[model samples]
Target: MEFTFLFSQFMSGLTYGLMLFLVASGLSLIFGVMNILNFAHATLWLIGAYICFTFWSLMEAHQFALWVSIPLAALATAATGWVCEVVLIKRIYKRELHEQLLITYAMALIFGDLIKIVWGPTDRLIVRPSIIQKPLFLFGAPIDSYFIFVILIGVAVAVGLWWFLKYTKYGHIVKAAVYSREMVGALGIPIPKIYTWVFTLGIFIAGLAGGVQSAIGSVTLGMDMNIIIQAFCVVVIGGFGSLMGTLVGSLIVGEVFSFAILYWPDGAMVLIFVITAMILIVKPWGLFGTPLRA
Candidate 1:
């Protein structure tokens, strides 16, 4: 019985960690490729959740409402990301670091307000489709069926990204651009265009994660605040631009938080920070990250 209980907790932690990976992977990708820290990424994710809710609400009578809404929300969010990149982010590419940070931070505030105005103060909930409405038992442990789906999505995204980076021409360009944007530009690649697409792609993943999250529970205002901080921690721990590191870091955080909550509910968050601090002290650039060039 005790083993079963522990297994359940482990599964819960794994689910939470994969969710973090979904959010942080895009974040890491954007920062790795563009050197831009997007303060509004989580806001964009929330926007995706809201968009999915809207779409699902519109077709609530149908069985396929949610399945269709997720991708639509992702595309819509990607479009918004593209607009931000073209109109605002593009202008800041060569600006001072503080200037870039200020603009993204401002964007976060603006987007947050927009979410309130559009969605109102009401919390949105997505009713699970009949298929995932019940729990599944694994070795005497009951697990939410939806959680399995989330895990699959996380794994798929990870493998898809790996294949893209390892096998595709554009992926190679993206990787090269990460190390030497100027050199890639000199070789005739359109650096600005790459930046635009990469930013859009990152937000698209965030949006997809959001859509998935909407089905997990109520979508409320200010939800992004909590997740954004954690997402940043995931990126920092995993090392920016390292997909494998992001996966491992997310699991570490998720499991640590899950188990810690059982033993020390009040200190769960503090413990996470303590671990982060230790990692930073030992390796300033992170476990998988290379040192920045002078």
Candidate 2:
């Protein structure tokens, strides 16, 4: 590919990577602290998009829709997570990994179909804000303002997470609990409540990610499936429980798929899996994960 072509591809890759990070961060967080594989995570994103579309359609202005849908979507996703935790995931924490995976996968299928029942099988689009519809020049290339927003939001989330983990008291508590759950519980910390909050927060992030994505393109019923597989690849490549790993893995996968499609349209999906398989063989715990702990 020519330099210009490669540059544009790289920019596209960055946008894709940021979107993946938005989804993967929530997955990583829940898995990191709770030790559960949440299959319904991507469905939450789809739910958020649908919720955004519903609100946007009801209220015609892009600004009004954007303002209302984000928090509403987040709240809806959080409530769903809380209910799922109470009704299902919490009970299966001590079960086999395969069992938890099976249950969550079932939940994903159920939730996805439920969304279809509510929103129908058609795709729905969000009206992008006027400001985001304009392109910004970067390095002699025009970039979508919406993509810039994704990158900025992702970076801000990363920084905020880092700061929360490093400086906040509750964050330290969570870290302690992650390392020594028994000891943290013994010290009078409400581990159950903490798990609930963490789980809810993760689901909310997934919802926010989806709501944001609605602005870029149409939200289809099957978008969850498309995103979940890539999110899973990111989780695997980054390791199940590592935040930084998720971020890096997302970028790698995003770039690989973007460039692969540019050169070999049919092989794009396979390339990342091939790379991930090779990496797992070399370093099973992922690039940033702690092998023994995870």
Candidate 3:
């Protein structure tokens, strides 16, 4: 491949990686705090896309509409997540992982059906904002403005979350919980409330990811399945629930998929799995993950 081709491929990889990071970060946060696999996470993302599209369609078409719709999408998904937690998930906090997974898996079906019932099975695309439809030159290659925004947004979120987790009182409590859940509960920290906050925060991030997704393409029913598999791969490779690991793992998986598609399209899907398996064999806890002691 020519140098220019390789450079373009790298850029593509970076963009895709950033997208994966946003989605995976939410998954990691939820798992890290709650020890539950949220089957409805990806569905929530797709819901955000539809919500954003609908909101934008209702408003006067302009930059203002774009700005308004994006936050609405995020907030709407967050609300759904909050409801899901309060109504069903809260009761399962002490259940085994497999049982939790079963409940959530059922929710995934319920969510998909709800989407179909509400939005129908038809494919719907969002209109990209004028601000994001243009392509800007990056290293002499034309990069889509929407992809650039995705990358910037991912970076901003990573930084903001890092600061929040590292500097806040909640962060300290979370840190304690991570090490010893029983002890933290004993210490008089409202464990249930903390879990609620953490889970809601995770859902909010997932919703934000979905909102960003809307700008790139139409919201479709299949997106939930598509993104969930990728997000799982990211979490596994990054070490079940590690934030920094999610970031690094996302970049690796994204770039690998991008470059593989450019060089050998057939192997693209299997490549991430292959690499993840190798990483787990060598370092089961992942690059940034810490194995818990019995």
Candidate 4:
């Protein structure tokens, strides 16, 4: 019984961590590559969740597969991200920091309202594929299949992202741009175009996370603000602009909440801050974060 409980907690923490990584990676990458701190990230997440629900419903009506809705949702949210960049974010590059903050906050409110208007003020549940409804056993310990599905998605996204950022030419360019956009621009690279692409990637990641996660529970109001705060916590604790840091931070925060709640349900969430403080005291920039440059 003890072993089963421990294993279950570990698996639960792992899935939660992976999902946090999916969300935090985008926040980190956007800051790393574009130097823009997006305030509407959670708004994007909620929108993606609704989009996922809508597409799945439409597809199910046509007798299509459930998994197809995930990509469609991702694509839709990615497109929305692009539109936002062109219409809103791009115009504010030279604005004051407070201006950016206000604009993003307003955008969040707008998106949040839009979600309520479309989906109504009720909880929505997604119908996952039939295969994921059962639990699987590994070494006599039963693990939920949906957890496995989420874990697989996390692994694939992590591996794919690593490969893209490490081996591809565009990846190197993104790195170079992150360090010094001026240098890249002087070398005849179009920085504006790169900015669009980077923002698109970040938003796409959030959408994918939302679509995958909505399968596990209800998609409802205030989810955007709730998860975004946690996502920001992951980014802040891990170090701004570091994907590896985001991953590590997500694991720390995720596990802290998962295991802590078992022992003290009311106090579990506070551990996230306590552990983050401990990490910050030792490595102020984060576990894998680089020191700031002039």
lDDT of each candidate versus the true structure: 0.92, 0.84, 0.84, 0.85
Best model per lDDT: 1
For every model shown, the clashing-pair count is 0, 0, 1, 0
**TM agreement with the true structure for every prediction:** 0.98, 0.94, 0.95, 0.96
Tens digit of lDDT per residue, candidate 4, span 159-275?
A: 888888899988888889878988999999888898999899989988998888778888989988767888888987889877778888888888888999888988877778787
Query: Candidate 2 on 141-196: residue-level lDDT in tens?
Result: 77777787788878887788778778999888877877888899999998888888
Task: Give the TM-score ranking, best first.
Answer: 1, 4, 3, 2
User: With candidate 3 superimposed using the best TM-score fit, by how many Å does residue 222's alpha carbon deviate from the native?
Assistant: 1.1
Candidate 3 clashing pairs?
A: 125-218
Q: Which 10 consecutive residues of model 2 have the lowest summed lDDT?
A: 59-68
Question: Candidate 1's residue-wise lDDT over 84-186, tens digit each?
Answer: 9999999999998999999999999999999999999999999988999998999998888888988888888889988998899999999998899999999
Clashing pairs in 4: none
Candidate 2 Cα errors over 4 Å, as ranges: none
Off by over 4 Å in 3: 292-294
Task: Tell me the tens digit of each residue's lDDT in model 3 across 1-294.
Answer: 667667767877887888888888888888887888888888888888888878888885676786788888899989998888888999999888789999999988998898899989888776765766777777777777777778888899899888888899998888778778899999899998888888888888888888888877767888889778888888888887678899999999999999888778998988888998899899888878888533
* Winning candidate number (TM-score): 1
